[model samples]
Target: MSINRSVENMAKGGMSMEEFKAWVRENIDADEDGKITKDELADIIRRNGEWFAGWKARKWMRSADSNRNGVVDEIEIGNLAEFVQKHFGIKIIS
Candidate 1:
């Protein structure tokens, strides 16, 4: 599902941040590698209905990838979540 749809679902279901993070891992981690790459992040942003998905993804990746390992690993997901909330208006109940 798209990120916007997911957010709507989350809002309707009252998901916590932890649950939303898990949802990202399960749904957005297309490679199933337990990490989110820039491409994957871009895809998610694109799915969120952003016309400038690539640019937004690059910005978010740069901000969230604290380790500079070219991927957002588990530790960096919090950063990703914050960015998503701030930029996409995704509200996590917790």
Candidate 2:
């Protein structure tokens, strides 16, 4: 699927950033750091299959990582939520 379609699917599927953060905390944050490492993020994308391709994953990390930090924290996740809301017109209450 195209990037737009992937985003649309995420919105349509009702996967809010808060929910995603929980998922990350439960599944990706194995180190218990409250932040998702790049490797963990990439692994999640890979496990999810083609929708979260390498390029898209990198793009998302770059876009969401506002502080340019290596990991994605709560603030960056909020930014991602905003991006989804703005781009897909989905209101995610957080």
Top TM-score hit:
1
Q: Lowest-lDDT window of 10 residues in candidate 1?
A: 1-10
For model 2, residues 1-94, the per-residue Cα lDDT tens digits are 2323444455564676667567557756778888866677566556656565666667667767888887788777787666556655766666
lDDT values for all models: 0.79, 0.64
lDDT of 2 at 70: 77
Task: Kindly provide the TM-score of model 2 when superposed on the true structure, using C-alpha atoms.
Answer: 0.62
TM-score of each: 0.80, 0.62
User: Which ten contiguous residues of candidate 2 have the minimum total lDDT?
Assistant: 1-10
Clashing pairs in 2: none
Off by over 4 Å in 1: 1-3, 12-14
Q: What is the lDDT of residue 59 in candidate 1?
A: 89
Cα lDDT for residue 80, model 1?
83
